[model samples]
Target: MDGILVGNRLIDAGEYELAIDAFTRAALDQGLSADVLAGMGSANLGLGRVHTAERLLRDALEKDETSPEIWNNLGVALLEKGEIAEAEQVLKRAYALDNGQSDSIRDNLRLVLAKTENSVYDEPQEQDYKLIRRGSSDYMIRTISD
Candidate 1:
């Protein structure tokens, strides 16, 4: 079975508690694609494991540093950790990487900025869905891992 498929199952099962371990295992075990890293990062982020999530996300980014998805997620992790400056920087990188991904990057940037300001804006209110790092390239794994 595909690592992404299995990872998605764990995520849907709300077993994110175990999904990271599973994803990490699958990725390393199979020498899988960047999707594996994305899944692991997502699971860790769900568990509020920012550092781990960042690591995984970085791995994904290193595989494809130009991917807006990776940059956006790194920004989100930094944002949630109250690293607004870092978050903004990542967001900018994401936006610069792909203008086509502007919506996601903008939304993520808005969320972090709002949190920083504690401003009352129309939040997404989509609790189950969050900004996860995805779509990184295989090449990005090396640089991001470091």
Candidate 2:
């Protein structure tokens, strides 16, 4: 459980690579639990590997369907993949499962709702560039317009 705790803290600190390592170590040592799978899924999500994250979260859910955190992370993976409708439904499920106790889940649900509302009238457009952040804690998203 110590490794899982370390992995969780690493994830919260935004050290995704290190968190993955920690979770991997935990899985090797104590076997894969739903918590470990969720931590790895969340780490992959933070690394922008949405498909991998989704897969991992799904596996975690199969092991423990009652986990709100797993559902929330799965919803985030779907959201990042642009499956807004499915993301909204999954996030709402997470919110309901958790009894609306998680602010992050609520915020993510709101974000999906807002995006879905905006996408109704806006045609799909190709994006030339995307904003990326650097460093730890302190970060910024700069748009490089063509």
Candidate 3:
């Protein structure tokens, strides 16, 4: 199989290091396409390398701005870096570009909005819930009221 396909499969299997190796090989052989860059970015993101993921995803977007997958991955990278506002904008753009067909994009946008909306409180007394990531997904859980 091609390196790109292998990279994607490795990503799906949560083998981020292997995925990055596969993506790098593909990039060296075929030059970096949007899909390859996206895969690399996502693998980096999975490994908690937010800055590297952001750069690669941005490069992917430059090569092909029309891909919702790239935009969504970029948004995720931004969110991981705590760039909530930019992440929201990019995720919204991805949702719009996909015509709201991507549930993952929609969920990401919702997560950003939830984080932003709940972060406005000045004290723990005023806060109701906190967003937490469990495994590969995020959840808003109610905090113990003081």
lDDT of each: 0.65, 0.74, 0.74
- The C-alpha RMSD in Å for every predicted model, in order, reads 8.6, 5.1, 5.3
Q: Judge candidate 1 against the unseen true structure and give its global Cα lDDT, from 0 to 1.
A: 0.65
Candidate 1 lDDT by residue in tens digits, 1-146: 76667776776666786776677678777764567776777677767788998898988876767677667767777766657678878877877787745565666666556554553455534333343433322111111222
lDDT of 3 at 140: 20
Give per-model TM-scores.
0.67, 0.81, 0.81
Better of 1 and 2 by TM-score: 2
Candidate 1 versus the native: TM-score?
Answer: 0.67
Shift of residue 115 alpha carbon in model 3, Å: 1.5
Backbone clashes in model 2, listed as residue pairs? none
Task: Give the Å error, residue 101, model 3.
Answer: 0.7
Error of 3 at 35 (Å): 1.2
